[model samples]
Target: MTDPMQDPGFLQDPYPTYAAMRSRCPVQPVSTGSGGHISYLVTGYAEARQALGDARLSKDTAAFFAGKESRRRLHPAVAHTMLATDPPQHTRLRKLVTKAFTTGAVAELRPFITQVTDELLDQWPVGEPFDLVARLAVPLPVIVICELLGVPEGDRPDVRRWSAELFAAGKPDVIDTASHSLADYMTGLITAKRLDPGGSLLDRLIAARDGDDHLSEEELVSLAVLLLVAGHETTTNFLGNAALALLQRPAELDHLRKNPDEVPAALDELLRFDSPVSTATFRFTTEAVTLGDTDIPAGVPVLVALGAANRDPERFPSPDLLDVDRDAAAHLSFGHGIHRCVGAPLAKAEAEISLRAVLARFPGIRLATPPDRLDWRRTRLVRGLASLPVLT
Candidate 1:
């Protein structure tokens, strides 16, 4: 069968395809669009959980891309970031920045998040249709991340633009250009922090590099770039997806509106219903491993379908239905194992705060157009909408 992934309808709503794939077998091989490389896609809940934390599965990209053409297309800084490396290298890099991104550290930003939410809400046009994605979802995170990194306010729009371009999967050249541009911008920012440090996270990272030699210049640049890009990009999509899910299910939206305390639970259910990240980043096997009943050879690439795993019938009953009261905290939307997202707490806080504020301010909000007509982003990695027009 032709890969359903190549179809536009599938990209817009892949749950049906994932359901069929999961029913056939938990693990199956599929060809990656790039280089015709075969990668095992693990869709079952149990298999995905095991594969995520499996030490034999390597995050090293070099092992998967040995050809000159493959090597030429990727930037070393991007290929060397914490996400692309295994411990103890990944351990060291993660530790250097983990302190600043801890749950406690991120929780400290609640006031700031609320403030940003309030300010953005105040700008919405009264009784008119507007794009929530462009106005709220995108800027909220971009502003928060930039402020955390000590990036000046004026430069945030560029950061958001570059981040979006990096996710333009249909255009490899555009992705490459965005990657190089973002890397260069971070390189310059790191250099500036080194000369005159502030109290921000970037300053602390510079201290680690200059003080203990814990981080090299290349690693510094790469880490900053990763934080900046992933920091905003993930939460942006999360907010958009969460809002879209709620608006489509007015009953669930009303339930949350009535029981405001259940906002956190709603976030979890929404996350499982429509994960912002469809699949965890690439994982290559270091040695031959058996996942479920399938034997995957060493050096082969593996992709854990987080979105699919969350919907696995064995894990959650009536997986297609959104039950706000259901305990969906175990969902792998933020991923699992040592590579789990460090900024998850912040993302959750942002979503909860933003959603509550939007609901409170716009009680009559509804989809301006039919749900099926909404344009979803045509990307495999990040599943989200191109725009979310709503009547406020």
Candidate 2:
């Protein structure tokens, strides 16, 4: 089973494996490739939902690695992010940046998002196959998130590169290098924001850093790095998976193209079918915990298999089928409880607008290569294709 994860069959189609795993106990230890750490993977819908919000399972990577030289390569800014910490620290950090991603704020960006989608689609080479990942999925979100965060357009290529490298799963040194580089880059930008506070989201964050209720310098840099990376990475992969899902099912793709209004609602089902986030960030057990009737010892890591939970037959009938009309709202793609993804609203808006536009602009779009030939990224956490070549 350990070697199967690296197998091409498992990489292209893990859903069958997930179904087999779920048929056993929903929560059990598996070879999650956590660098020899004995990790438990939660696959049942109820178990995953419970573990996501379980207070006994901590996210404090900083405290866990304290006085231990094992993780010395991890920068402070990358280590202490909201994603890796439990409340009240997670609460304080989430509150400071929550305003920028509120529903109303995301609503205001709809027009801009559509404009960007149209602009990106405008340059498509006529009647030729192009790598959708390179031409559209990757750039659309990079442009939107960069503008939202006030990242200078010139530095975006570097930011994109560093962000991609940050997810190098097994390469510790590469991950360490990217984390430090991004942190140092953000530190300089934050200092500049202090002198000239333009009205970007980063400017607002800087104002909060200096205001009465302040964020520590490390927290500021950490939060900036988190937003810069997750703000678009998740959405980029989501779009790639979504497009692939639709291309495989011509009926479903046409159903939405005829009724574009349904595109927004369909995102939930699309996400459920093939979640971009294969597993939610791992949680460490503060004390002994029981999930899905399985007892786990204290000081162990728990990985919630979001992709499996979303496809649980018990949770959603015929989970393998993508029914756009189904109420797939409960899927764990964006996670659950307090640590749920904060940028979900923005990601959804960006995905819906971009997906709909892609369908409209190129109704004849089809995969240029065989589905089995597509390669998936090597990263363990993010589930996405290496490239999506399509003919327009």
Model 1 deviation from native, Cα RMSD in Å:
1.4
Over 4 Å off in model 1, which ranges? none
Q: How accurate is candidate 1 locally (lDDT)?
A: 0.87
**Which ranges in model 2 have alpha carbons more than 4 Å from their true place?**
1-4, 32-35
Colliding pairs, model 1: none
Model 1 TM-score (2 dp): 0.97
| Clash count in backbone of candidate 1 | 0
TM-score of every candidate: 0.97, 0.97
